[model samples]
Target: MESSTQLVILAGLVIGLIYGAVGLLSGFCLMSSMRGWLAQGDGRLVRTYALAMAVAIAASQLLAGSGMADLGKSIYLQQSFSVPVLFLGGLLFGYGMVLSNGCGSRALVLLGRGNLRSFVVVIVLAIAAQMTLKGLIAPARIALVQASQITVNANSLPSLLAAFGAAEATSRALATSAIVVALILFAFAHPSFRRSPGQVAAGVIVGLLVTGGWFVTGFLGADEFNPVPVTSLTFVAPIADSLQYAMLSTGLTPNFGVATVAGVFAGSLITALATRRFQLEGYSSPRHMLRSAGGAALMGVGGVMAFGCSIGQGLTGLSTLALGSFVAVAGILLGTAAGLRGSLRVQPLAVA
Candidate 1:
């Protein structure tokens, strides 16, 4: 590979390491946060999540505004996207996250702590994601997207504002300010969340990490001759790609995503070991195993269709202010709500 590619890969690994450690230490899972807020009547974790979103938006937009990274290059900024497909995908992924008790990133962190059940989740999720991305499910996914996708004049929030009347910089600033302010207000409104400094730091660090991923791929990896993909931290496709690379190293070349995926597992493992938190764990029963497997499959398929997982669309994608990301995120929140409240809520499973 090129020298720039190596640097990008190394950066990806570092970013993943930090992410894994922070996620494990802070219990940074969207499903868990939602469950805590809606079901358990605790909003601290969700507040942390909101802060992370606020930071990600502020930092990412700054990078883009400074011409350091082109957010336009990312998949989330596509001119044409399917509202139905993306929303449906988000709903599936969110509900699956509830069923599985976590998202892909959380599973990786838990697996690092010797959760054998997460191992199953990781493997099954990877396989299912791969199938959706390029295997048997790809054709159907592609057909659906092609059929339902709609073209829009403005792909991102800033662009939408620019189209109306504002200059590019003004539009970006306005949009970013609106979102960042709202998120910050939500995050800091609760005294309980404000008191949790560790959670606050995790949110800031994770947000910065998302920006770091963009810097690595969009700036550090930028080469006229051998250009690397302008992307950042997202686990769905990367987890699948990591699995494929592990099995087919002879033919595949490592990229930012795969390297990050490996680093997350390794970093979480090290943290768990150092903290004496590592302990082997598995499914409670066959029924539990089945539920987990089914959830994994749904996450894989849904994540692919939505073009990201929780961390993917919720944080990284939203950082770009993409319209589709908003749609997908809305779906994810609604889906999570469905699983957390009302008649559709998923009840706690009984131990076997």
Candidate 2:
């Protein structure tokens, strides 16, 4: 193994540990957060997510401004941004998360805690993601992406702001900082939320970890001769890739995504065990299993089409200031709202 690959993998594991720890500690699940806001009128969790995004955008943009990283090369910054596909993907992913009771990252955290239901979810999600990415659903996905994509000279938010008359440097700083400030204020505006130090810490730490993911892949792991793909944390393709690695270890080497995914499970397991929260769990009935499986399948397909999962687009992709990230996130939120209360709400699953 090359020294650089080893370093990347090690870095990925450390970052994953931090992210997973924060996630488990704070109950960091996008699906739950959104549902909390829309269905329960509880905004604390949503605020946590906002805090995470704010930290990610500010820190990531700073790295780019310092010339330490090139976020422009990320998949989120593609010249041709697909609108319809992202919307459809978000819708599917949002509703699926509701049905499964969690998002991809949340599922990983749960799996580490001995939740057999999460294990099933992880497996089904991976298989479904693989199908959408390169298997049975690939052709249709490609067609949808190709048909819905729009070519832009600059598809990123900062660039668009600059185009609208802000100076490039000012635009980047203003665009990024404004969102961060608003999120920070929103997160702390409530006295109740302000009192929850653990939740606050989780948001900040998770957000920084997004920046950390970018640094590991874009800066520390950069190799001009054998350049790794410029990316940060995301779970869609990585889940599928992780499953593939497990089955095809003899022929394949681990990448940042796979290592990070593996690390999430490991980190969560360690945390769960240490905290004495490691209890084995599974579905209560066949119907519960079926709903979860169906949800996992939708998430797999939707995540691929949207090009990211909640943390993938919500934080990692948004870190790049890409317009598509904004769009996809909006779609995800809309879909989540629907599933939580609007019209697509699934019945509650029985707890085992």
State each model's CA lDDT, in order: 0.93, 0.89
TM-score of each: 0.99, 0.98
Q: How many clashes show up in model 2?
A: 0
Task: For candidate 1, write residues 1-352 as lDDT tens digits.
Answer: 8999999999999998999899889999899999999999999999989999999999999999999999899999999999999999999999888888899999999999999989988999999999999999999999999999999999999999999999999999999999999999999999999999999999999999999999999999889899898999899999999999999999999999999998899889999999999988877889898998888999999999999999999999999999999989988888888987888888788643
Q: What is the lDDT of candidate 1?
A: 0.93
Off by over 4 Å in 1: 350-352
Over 97-170, each residue of candidate 2 has an lDDT whose tens digit, in order, gives 89899999999998888899999999999999999988999999998888878999878878998888889889
Say which candidate scores most in lDDT.
Answer: 1
